[model samples]
Each structure stands twice: as C-alpha cells, then as structure tokens.
Target chain A: MLISSAQGAVRAADTLITANWLDYLLIAIYFAFVLGIGFMARRQVSDSIDFFLSGRSLPAWVTGLAFISANLGAVEIMGMSATGAQMGLPTVHYFWVGAIPAMLFLGVVMMPFYYGSKVRSVPEFMLRRFGPGAHLVNSLSFALAQLLIAGVNLYLLASIVHALLGWPMWTALIVAAVIVLSYITLGGLSAAIYNEVLQFFVIVASLLPLTLIGLHRVGGYGGLKDKITAAAANNDKITPAKDQLESWPGLPLSGFDSPLLSVIGIVFGLGFVLSFGYWTTNFVEVQRAMASNSISAARKTPIIGAFPKMFVPFIVILPGMVAAVLVNEIVQLKASGGEAAIPGGASGDVKYNDALLLLMRDVLPNGLLGLAIAGLLAAFMAGMAANISAFNTVFSYDLWQTYVQKDKPDHYYLGIGRLATFAATVVAIFTATIAGKFGNIMDYLQTLFGFFNAPLFATFILGMFWKRMTATAGWMGLVAGTLSAIAVWSAGEFGKAFELSGQGLAFVAASTAFVVDIVVSVVVSLMTAPKPEGSLKGLVYSETPKEDLIDPHEASLPFFQRTVPLALIALAMVLVLNVIF
Target chain B: MSHTPERYDAEDARDDVREDVADAGTDTGSGRHTAGAFDIRNIIGALLSIYGLILTLASFVGDQSLDKTGGVRANLWTGLALLAAGLAFMAWAKAKPIVVPDHIPHDDDRPAGH
Candidate 1:
C-alpha cells in the first residue's frame, strides 16, 4: 500500500490539472462575455478617436480599473508569483517600494502634462515636445516593443490552454490569438478597457481563494514561516530564511552581497528608474488614463489604480510563498536547483514559473479550479489585447497616418487602425514563437523595457521641465541613452564587467541609460537652438498656465475626490505598509 | 479651442439620432446615462452572476474535495461572495449611473504641424 501511494505521487505530476465539465462551462461563459463586450463596444466606435482613445469619455472608476488591469498581464501574475516562490518576501518591493510612489508622481505631476496636452499616445506627446526625428524613433521602437511583448503574453496564454485542455500547441496558439483578435478588432480600445476592468475582478476572485486555501493548508502565515525556516536550514542552495522573510535590503533579489549596495539598487534602480519609467510613460498603461472623460478623471486614474495595486501582493505573492512551503513538487525542484521535470508544466521543466499552477492543482476543487483557469485566461487576454490595441493606435496615428498616408479622413484612419490591429495580431502569433526560444522570458522583457522606456523617461522628464531643451537634444538624447543601455546590458549579459546578473543587470542598464540620456540632452541643448517659447506653450510645464494644467472644477469636490489629497493619502498608506512589512 | 463649437454641434446631432433610436425601442438604453450604449457594470455583474451560480450549484452537486482544501467548502463560500459582489455591482450601477454629456472636446483634433 505504501509503495503504491508513492507511485501515485509520481503519476500525479503528469496529470496536474484535471478539470471537470463544470470548469469548462465557467471558462466558456467567460469567453462569451469577453467576445460579447467586444461586439457591443464595436457599436460605439464612430471615428478614430473612439477606436483609439474611447473618445476620452470613460469615467475615473472604469479607466482606473483598466489602468491597473492592462498592467496585470500574464507576466504580472505568473512572473510575480514565481518571484514570490523564489525570492519570497523581497518580491513585495516591486509593488510598495517600486510602484506606488512613481504611480502617485505620475498622477500628481505628470498626468497634467500628458492629459492637459491631449496627446493621443505617449509617442505623440514626444512629437509635441520634440520633433519628427524623436517622434519617429519613439513610434517605431514602441510599436516593435508592443509586438514583442504581445507575443510573450500570447505565448503564455496559448501554453495555459494547451496545458488545460491537452490541445496541440499550434491549435492552442491559433485559438487563443483569434479570441483576443476578434474582441480587439471588434471593439478597439473600448472593448479592451471594458474587458480589462472585468479581468481585474476575475483575477482577484481566482487568486484570492487560492491564497486563502493555500494559507489554510499550510497552517496560516505562522506555519508557512516555520516551514520556510526549516526548508532554508535544510537547503543551502536557496536564499536565507531571514532575507526571505523581510522586505528590506533584498540582497537575494538584487543579487548583491552588500546590504547598502542592495538597498541603493532597489531604491534608485528598480524603484526610481524602472518603476517611474514604466508606470509613468508606458503607452499600454498611459492609454487607459488618456481615455478618461475629463482631465481630473485622467489625473485620478493612476492614483485610483495605485489603491488596488498596493494590496495585490497579498493575492499574487502570498500564494507563491505558500506554494514554496506547501507543494511537494516545488520543494523538491527548489532543492534540486530546478533540474527536475515539473510533470504537467507547459515548459516541461521544473521552473519557478510553475509554482502557481502546482499550488492551484494541490488546493482547488473542480468548480473553483475552472474559475482560476478562466482568471489566468482573462489576465493573458487582457495583457495581449492591451499590447495589440496600443500597437494599432501607435501604428495608425504615429506611423502610418503621420508618415505613410497623410491628410486622411477620420474614418479612413480608423480603418487603418483596425487593419493595423489585424496585422499586429498576426505578427504577434509569429513573435510568440520567438519568445518561446528564450529560456527566461522575464529577463528578456526587463531587457526590452530597459532598452525602450528608461531613455524615453529621461528625455520626457528633461524636456517637460527644461524649457531650453532643443528638438535636436530630444532625438540625440534618446539615441545615446538607448546605445548606452544596450552596451551596459551586453556587458552584463556576455562579459563580466558588472558583478550583477538577471534583474540586477536590467536595473543597472536602465540607470545607465537614464543618466546618459540626461547628459546627452543637456550637452545637445547647450549646442543647438531650443524651440521658441511660443511653440512650447502647452508642451513645456513652465510655459503652460497652472489653470490650464488642471481642472478648476476639481477644487470644489470633496477631499476623497480631489487628486492631490487622494494621492497624499495613498502615499501615506504605502509608507505605512513599507514600515509594517 | 477653435474647433470647440463645431465639435459640440456634431455631438448634438449624434445625440438626437441616439434619442430617436431609444424612442424606437431598438436600443435598450442600458447606457442612457453613460457614454456608450452599454454599461460595463452590467457586463461585469452578469458574468460574475453566471459564474457564481455555476459554482454555487456545483458546491451542492459536485465532489466536495474537502480533503484537498483541508476540510473547507471553498466553492460554496467563494460562490456566495461572488454572488454578493455581483449583486452589489448591479445595485451600484442602478444607484449611481454615469451621465454622458452631449459633447466632450478633444485636446487637439488636427494633426501635429511639422
């Protein structure tokens, strides 16, 4: 009997996810709602603006949920949980220390410039501040980045479907792509945003139960802590229990031995450069804010998102921690230094990425298991749709409309946007194959962000505030910054120049890019002539009047509704959370 | 600023057409107060309600799997919570419907001059 029970454990790994009919029904219902929202939203798209920006008419709550949901893609869910399983408590820094402050800064300081200027996309904002050179560079790079990232999301989504239903990989990929493509093509940004809002709730619903059930199984947080401590003592390969339990310094997460250097890397590199660069400027996130009905709503969007954003670690990261302690497969894989096969994992290898799936298989029953599967689908689709929608907008407005075909009618551009969406979806299917080639897609994703966003953020912060920054400086700064980042990344990737590896390398690369861009912009501005003060009126912060930057009506609202007060409250809450954890 | 009046007149015309459609009963007017023709809340509420119903029914009829979750009836509880949340969203939508204005001007409708 004992021998047979042991043999059963070995067999259980091969068939990890076994969903009954009830689970499939839940997933079918979810897909129906997703596609239905798309068809409904299609009716509202009368022009390019509606197709691209939802006609800037959505309220704060909808756009706010969409803002965070667009970001809560497959990477955010699976990747963060994987990180939680690997690095433990230090992963919380990605949210509290890294995201919240920058998000608040975007709301209080940056949203006024972005929304007040009324740019269709982030690249368009670059065009207004810089010129054709910078705009072209920004547009092409952004479009390429979206396609690559969309591929990553698409690949993960298809892999989940393949794992869940035992479908062939090719069939899974095509079926997943068509679902997202159909909705995005039908509804445009409105469809994407509505689905995103729905996705957010679905994600929370699915993960929250997993976390609770896992915690309950492990004898709560206290029991998990004891198990982690015991595991750390037994396994010398993993991070120390103390480092795993605490959020400070994050030595293991940073890949640095020295505590001081690790803190600086976490605070400046990840928190300031990468975090601010991403939350403030990424068009995928910024487009949600731009779809708001009013300037005040736009400003409140990110700030509202920040509220839910801070607490997400509980559902996402906690489950990972629980899995690390509770799941026999993960424990064995971790001890084996991830050399073992993860049984039913899509990758065929025991990777940290399989932590969430393993945990769900161990804990959830059939009915709830189906809900969790649907949640993951919603996350990946929301992520891919965001990339595709943002890609189509930038392609139509920033690239094709601006350069390829000028002076087009509104409906003509709208048609181009839909075509671009189709082209991007098809391109993304191919890109997903490219993404599959990489061993760790997260490292690749971080490297891509470092290449595109870091330098762009540097140029934006400089040009927005410094009235004397020239158009020549704008493009030059971006080029030099990107090259410097690439150089730093390659040095770390291939050579032994930097002591860092993994995410630490990406952070260093981003910081180098930011500093290089600033230096280049300053030097170029000093040499070349600046744009005239008249042309810089609304683009430059100093030249734009205070009233024009904000909604005067927002002052009459209650403190909770006001942007500044709400941001401050959020800021205070995050700081308290930092102290407690 | 220059395109403000023209944009408003265009929106007013669209509003008139929408009102006529609403009177004809072809349009359900789910978003009569909202910007679009459909309320996102209703979609969310409807989806959650369906999922909640399935889970709730399954909790009674399907395998309990109480041993897997350490003796907890997770489906029953989570289904009830979802049902409550779904009903709350529906109620909130009914209580405070968003008012869509006739026109909301764009920041700049024209192409950026090179």
Candidate 2:
C-alpha cells in the first residue's frame, strides 16, 4: 500500500515537472501579445486626467464591462472558488444579495453625484465638501489602502500561477507585474481597461467550457446529482451546520439553532458582505463607473451589469460541488494524474484551492489546457492591471502630486505617475510575503481593506447627501471608523477565525464604521456652520439634473428592486437541490 | 438655410484647402489624431460580463434536480443560461452603435487670442 501511494505521488510529480519548452513558449507568446497591446496603447497617453481617468471618455457599457473585469482577477476567481469548495452553494449569496444591487444603485444613484460634480478622484469629493484637511487625510488613507491591496492581488495571482505551471514563484510574480505595468505605464487607464476587456473574454471562455466538460465527465447533471446525494447521505458538511443556521450580521434572522438560519445567514451574511463591499466603494469598481462619458450613461451601466451578475453560482461554484460528488469515485479509481487523485479538505482546505486547478488538469485535453492556462493568465492580468492602475492613480494624483510637488508641469506629474506605478509594484511584492504568513489571509486582508475604506466610504457618502458635513467631521469620522474596525478584529470578537466563509467579521466592522461616520459627520456638520455656499456647491451637487439637490425618488423600481428577490429565487433553487440530493 | 455658419460646396471645398494649409507646420498638432486607444464599450461589456459570470456560477452551487432521462440537461440548462446571458450582452453592444463625444471641455481657460 505504501509503495502504491508513493508511486501515485511520483507520477503526479512527474506530470507537473515535465512542463516543457512548449509551455514556456506558450507563456512567452501570451506575454508578447499582452505587451503588444500596451505598445499599441502608448500613443493614447496624454496629460494627468487622461492617464488616470481614461480622459472620462468611456461610454456606459465600456465602463460597466471594464469595472467588472477589473475586479475578476485570479485572486477573486481562486478565492471565491475556494470558498465554494469549502462552503457550498449559499456562498454566492455575497454577489447576488449584496454586490449586484449596490453596483446598480451606485450607477443609477451615486454616479451622477460623482460625475456631475466633476471630481477627479474619490478623495477630491471629500476635500471639496470638508476642506483641504479632509482631502489630505482621505488621500493618504486611500494610498495606503491601494498599496496593501496591490500586495494581496499579486500574492493571489502568484500562488495560482506557481501551482499550475512550475514557474518559480518570483518569476510568476514579476512576469505578472511586468505585464500589468507595461500596459498601464504606456497606455495608462485606457490601456488597462482595454486589456481588461480582452482578459475578461479569455477568462470566461476558458472557465465556462471547462465547467461544462467537467459536468460531462461526472456523468452530466444527473451523475453529479447522484454523487452529491450519496455524499450528503454520509456527510453533514454538504448541508448547513446546526449552529450556522442563525442570523445575518445586521438584518434579523430566525434565532440561532433554527436549521434554516444557517442557510439564510449563508445567503445573506457571507454573500451580501463580500459582494456589497466590492461593488460599492472599491476604487477599482468605482473608477470604472466614474469613467462613463455621461451621467445618464453611468447610471445605466450597473443595471446592465447586474442583469448577468445574478448567475454566478451556476458556473464557478457548482462545479466544486460537482467535484465533491465525484470525490469518492475519483479517489477509489485513483485515476491517472490530475484532480481525480485528490479529495476535498482531505489533506487540508488548501486542496480546496486545488480543486478547480486539479479539475482542469485532469479533464481538459492538451490544446484546451493551453486555453485554460491562457484564461487563468487573463484573470491574473485583468486584476493586476486594475490594482496597479488604481495604485498609480492614487499615488501620483492623490499622494505625490498633492503632497510632494504642489506645482509641477503636466509632463513632470506624468513621469511621477509612472514612477509611482513601479514603486507600488515593489512595495506590493514585499507585502505579499507578509500575506503568505497568515493562515487564512482572506478575512485579515478584507478587514484591513475595510479599515482603510470603511471610514472613506462613510465620508464620501455623507459628503454627497449632507451639505453640512464639515471636513473635520469627515476626517474624525474616518479615523474613528478605522480604529473601531481594528479594535473589533484584534479581540477575537467574531468567534470562528473563518466565520461566515471569512467575511462576516469584516462586514460587521465596516458597516459599523459606515453608520457611525454618518451619524457623527451629520451631527457635527449641523452643529458647525455649512461650507461657504458656492465654494463647495460645485463639488457636491449638479444642477442640470434637477433631481440632484434632493434624494432621488426611491419609487417602485420593478426591475431594480427585484434583483435581490431574483437572487433569492436562485438561492432557493440551489437549496432545493441540496435538500433533494 | 438658417445662416448658422452655412457653407456652400464650393466655399466649403476652398475652406478645407485653406485649413489644410493653415495647420501644416505646428509640431503639437502635426500627425496627431484624436481617436482614443480605448473603447469604453468593450471594457464595460467585459466588466459586466465577468460579474455576470460570477453570479451565474454561484447560482448553480446549490442542489437541483432534473429528469434522470435527460442526461446533461441540468448542466446544459445552466451553461445555456450563462452563455445566453454572456453572448447576448456582447451581441447587444455590437448591435447598438457607440457615439463618441466630439470634444471634452477643458477647465483652464486662456485669453481669447493667445
């Protein structure tokens, strides 16, 4: 038995080790193609706004597509797929419940405020509403946030690339960084977004076909059903744990111990938090929306984006559950190489990360495998481009230009922007090593992300709606929010380390900060005098859309409001399947 | 007809010639074209696509039942749903033409005859 086990391991190692010059050639070809896109985009680069904002030239659809593509990096794909492998179907509740609608609302509601106000950066809004002091604080915090974020993205992409191809870890990291930096430096936002558009296609084409092929190999849907049903017969992890069937973080739930509560919590808590935060305030997301050619175009983009967002689980997550069904079949047969040899969480949950990768290796034919690798690279590239670009924009425009050089030439600032992009890439690499040390870095990464963003989201939101929110109030609220989230995270207060699939604690902290910032900023702004009239009016409101001064009517949004309900229906369908199986 | 910078074919032809000659030598303007590198339409389509794909993938994770006789029906249904949604989007954008704005207004204003 020992000899046989060793032989199996040896064969697997050999298969991985034998990635040849062909593979390297393929990788090089991909890099060359991506760099070619960058070189093509160079002629478009101009002054600051064009570099940072794509010169605000994007129409609604382009903004929406680029926005979604920017965030769908290798990290999110691997991270979310890993979650599905561990947690099951309810995991998607994050995108369906929280993120989709928030993005839609951002487009239809908040975008006009930003676009109409003509603010160059998210921080610029805070500065105009409050003062230069608020701008300084927001800008500094955002720059730090992007710096940390750049590191996390690099780590996620590197891990996947190293695991699949036997590329040295740093090789993957540097290659990934270089690909993104080349385009961003040359073409700026335009190049980044354009490449992101291409990456988006390659990724979906790769993942979708592989998912279908896996389903076929597993004896189609019925075979998948039989396998999952058999597993559920033996294991409880296939269903919600008794304790987890409880409550959402903020919204009411049936008391804990109710069998349905865990499912509901899974649907809302895990699903809502992850999706909402990404959609609402993340710069990569907002930058896409802000690039719309017109306010009306911006508003329509998210609604269009959301219509398709309702279907995430069917493609990315279900494949894992299907893999779960085949776990025993694959293990017993001990099929030659690839996913068939490993089972879920058998070695550790890290194998769960290997689930999708393993599936592609075992099932896909050679040419198709090349396509899959290309798709994975696309995911990595799209995300890397977004992160580096966001870091560059914030550093050059928000940090260096604002702080380091008060009055510089347009060309000089552009040069600084390029330099900042390179420096940010280096800093991100160092932080990635720190990221590797954490056992489950998702929650910590998220909470830290929230620490920077929670305060900022609150200040941005308040600055738009409320006239009186002073700069001091915005700054104080921001500081208060970050401090509160950190205090909550450090005390082991949320119970399990990976509670609610790793996002519940961070969500609670961020939501708390958002609320507190609003209450404090509003009260203080009222107590203090309003900003001196027209001085700040141009920063916050737009007159052409008469709806700007007041809260836009929350009338019956038959299509808009139903997104959550539609999500719930989809969730119900999944739950019904789990029950039957 | 309304005298809003109206130009007859002969006059417009002469004017075009004059403008071509007028703009021949300026380094800043020479050989420079305004066509942008990026197409917001494609980027937005791609972004919406990825998010849509994620959501679609999520919906399939839970348990569902299909006719035993209809082999691969469920997977097919799910794939069809995703492909339909994804492709429909790409197709719709292709059908609807994009209209680029003629110019972006600049914030800094210089004296009229610099």
Candidate of highest DockQ: 1
Give per-model CA RMSD: 5.9, 10.2
lDDT of 2 by residue, A210-278 (tens): 677777777777676565455445444343322112113212121234346544544443344334445
Alpha-carbon TM-score of each model against the true structure? 0.92, 0.74
Candidate 2 TM-score, true structure as reference = 0.74
| Residue lDDT tens for model 1, A186-230 | 989989999999999999999999999999999999999999899
> What lDDT, from 0 to 1, does candidate 2 have?
0.57
Off by over 4 Å in 2: A1-29, A236-277, A327-349, A493-502, A538-581, B1-114
Output the number of the lDDT-best candidate: 1
